[model samples]
Target: MADSAPEVPAEERQEDPDVVDRKAEVLAEQIKKSKHFIVFTGAGISTSAGIPDFRGTEGVWTLMAQGRQRPSAVNTLQAVPTATHMALVELQNRGILKYLVSQNCDALHRKSGILPDRISELHGNNNREYYFRAVASYEKTVHDHRTGRKCVRCGGDLLDSIVNFGEYLPAEPLRLARNHAKKTDLCLVLGSSLTVPPASGIPETVGTRKAAKLVICNLQETPLDGLVDQRIYSKADELMTRVMAKLDIPIPQFILRRRLIVQMETTGGSRHQLKICGVDVDGTPMTFLRSIKLDQYCRRAACIEPFTISFRSDLDIGTELKLELEFMGNYGEPNLEIIYSYTGEAGTEMMYLLEYNPQTGEWKTERQESQSVDEDKKPTRRGR
Candidate 1:
């Protein structure tokens, strides 16, 4: 990133109403004519989708500078990508956009369907993994993080990719972004004021050095506006939707894809009861269930993990039984329901991974796992 500069204070500037459409047409033409389009983003691009920018009227830093506390808003854990994110994904999917460089730490770009390798997060991503401070790959016991488990080899802790104040951006992602920015022929700075150092200098570093056109779409003026070829003061979603419409490209809708894997671990005994638990792709536990219907043969008692049943004592382990269970997202982020049906005996123990396909409304089971029972897994735990 370029050296940090004095932060740009937020302000309002209205564009002429008649020139808006003309500017959109110009943008469409620029995009069509350019061979390589690189998109640089900031917090503003996500504001329309519910995340506030850092320098907007209601921006967090703006309010902080005014000697006021930032307003409470929805946390990033629940924030979904906006239309701008989807549009970029479409452009990249069609090969119109070559690369992505983002200063914001929000994980929306990856959530919006961009491949991890195609984009570089200059700041960092929230949904990321970290290695133990001293654990080797082979010695790193891979238990569900939901168990509050520590590294078995060294008892070390993993870390997230969040960069707090006074911390420098990670090196690898920053290098990747700089490489892409330098080679960009057409760069669109979206929803960013370009006030920060290093990153703020990218447009000039790439655009002017390579003789590329710099198109900036933001609500307020930025430090780099004087050098910009086209500056549109507007919301990110509004501007991108119009630009995509002008190009006759439809924004692809993102569908939620979930997976559910249910496993049963039996404690060896004469009358063994298999413990049951299932988790989604994100490691969220499966708790809620759809209405369960029972017949005369299978009499179910109060439902419990691994399912509690009070069938006749004669039908114990080794007796043929059928169990149909429906699991759903606990927090409702994934609203799809998952159904799993097993035709094993009452005490049949096996580790199964069920892939949930929300698009087709079916659960696909995979090959069985040959692992032993884990004593630490709890029904109340959340996945990491």
Candidate 2:
């Protein structure tokens, strides 16, 4: 391969250890001095999460600069939070970080456990689908075939909220960023090369007053390098980990319990035998069952999803089937960075026992107590 090719190497662009540690100390001191620390982020911070940073040697921009084609991008939907992403989450919990202004639309921050009230997404979120009923932070996706991916209620296409290259930044995020920047004492920027657009101007909103300092941590020199109070030439995760260690703070662990639904539609099966299917939260497969339990009269395979079970019975078409369903599960191991990416801090575990009476055609929901830790089971997840 040519030296100019995007795949040139893993060794050519590594960070210098001495420089990384020295830069980390400066930011740690600033973090110690500041009462309010706001954060600004871009695509660079997400590199460790299997997403390419935009301006590094092999980044999207760097490759484009060399007149080379960008590599096949990772599926943004499958992208999870990096170590740096969870480090910020810990800062927020400690109250060291005040607010966030983000340029990337990967939704890792929110998925990393940052709340909508504290952070602003200047660009739109990839996971979000726009509709009239959609709220500001997160939206529950409802599947609709009539309009084909449209909002179930509004009959409008569920638009991916990401703003294109030339599109304007969303007003609410911009406004929140400006408001927070005005009083920020320290602005710690992560991974952003600060080149893009109107979103790039947000950190500048912090005026000269209040002695607001801009501390940027990026591998590459950004356009606003001259304006920064201090520049840390290191990867975000490395520096963030060092800073957290200096502060004697530990990165928070994530514990997640996602909900998936299972529905059945019987078709050509024998009247005595029945078939059931499972579906997940995002409505991927037609039948995605989390767990199944049945009596001696019936059999079930608890190990797999999208599996079919056959049972011989003398029941009518509209008979009420007795079954036990498992609903919640755990996610995100920050140490490994595979499978689950980020877990929420709320940290809850419980199941809702649901009963539907076929004769009455009425549905009822019953609350179940949180399962004992010993009884807790890891659920099988479908999406990447």
Candidate 3:
């Protein structure tokens, strides 16, 4: 269905370095002077992260049109945020970027530390699923919007959040994006071909305003290139790196952070069961952990949800339990060890925060005790 969309010539272009530098300086000035600055992004911004774009030379649509094999790409779950993604995060941290609108479902922008409230992912996120009454992440692989899981509240079927061909866009994200576009005085377009309507038209709206300025940075010519105030035929990462330097803002490095909630339940007598799983900041089930091992009990739970292990042992009030966690290894992260001490309580819960820096090959861990253990409690669902 994606191949049926409109196509542009697969011609890539790069502007001279000197010209790009000069334009970056001017863009930096515009960012500083503008009151309401916003950004619109597309799949091109993720190409550097091993994700292929739609209209590029080796893009999915381009390959389909040329009768060539589809280009192989890194799994969206394994890919890390690119330089451009991190740069945008830094910009938002400084309050220079008011809002962000993106057509990408890769979830890089959200993983790059951007707040969910500050961005509108118009196309929807691959990692998210929607029920009629709520939206959350699904544990199993979802196909054609069917997650094979029932809604906890209404007993309804859960659906994938991805917007397919002929499907109407989600209303809330579209409303927020249009509102931001109407109020934006400086709109920065990155990695977009400006071909897809609705999502593409948001940037054009800002460009049409008398007091607004629009700048586009992409490797291919966009339909709105001639009308834009500044057009740089360059990679999003390259141009954003220059712009950050001109603005004297340091681009932050990417750090992978995960939270794990561990709970222990007494089956009977000396028998006990321990459960462990990864969770997001907002308590959504995050399936980054591939396997878990309890070395003391010689038990392992891998390739399955509800990672629990049952064992019998005489435990003291302050017994230490060691767990070896094997992650997905997308960023070459090594297996981590978690040392949790038991409180000798039937429903005791412990939280662990793990941070990994791929650049330095370093890891940090923090442990906190939770007061409540509600197994039936569901994460607060959010609407896009």
TM-score of each model, paired residue for residue: 0.67, 0.63, 0.85
| Candidate with maximal TM-score | 3
lDDT tens digits by residue: candidate 1, 39-153: 9999888886677777677777766666667667767655667889999999999999999988887777876778767887876665553443223245434322222333222
lDDT of 2 by residue, 89-115 (tens): 888988888898898888788767787
lDDT agreement of model 3 with the native: 0.83
Q: What are the root-mean-square deviations of the candidates from the true structure over C-alphas?
A: 8.3, 12.3, 4.1
Clashing pairs counted in every model: 6, 5, 0
Best by lDDT: 3
Candidate 2 global lDDT = 0.60
lDDT of each: 0.63, 0.60, 0.83
Candidate 1 regions off by >4 Å?
A: 1-8, 132-156, 259-384
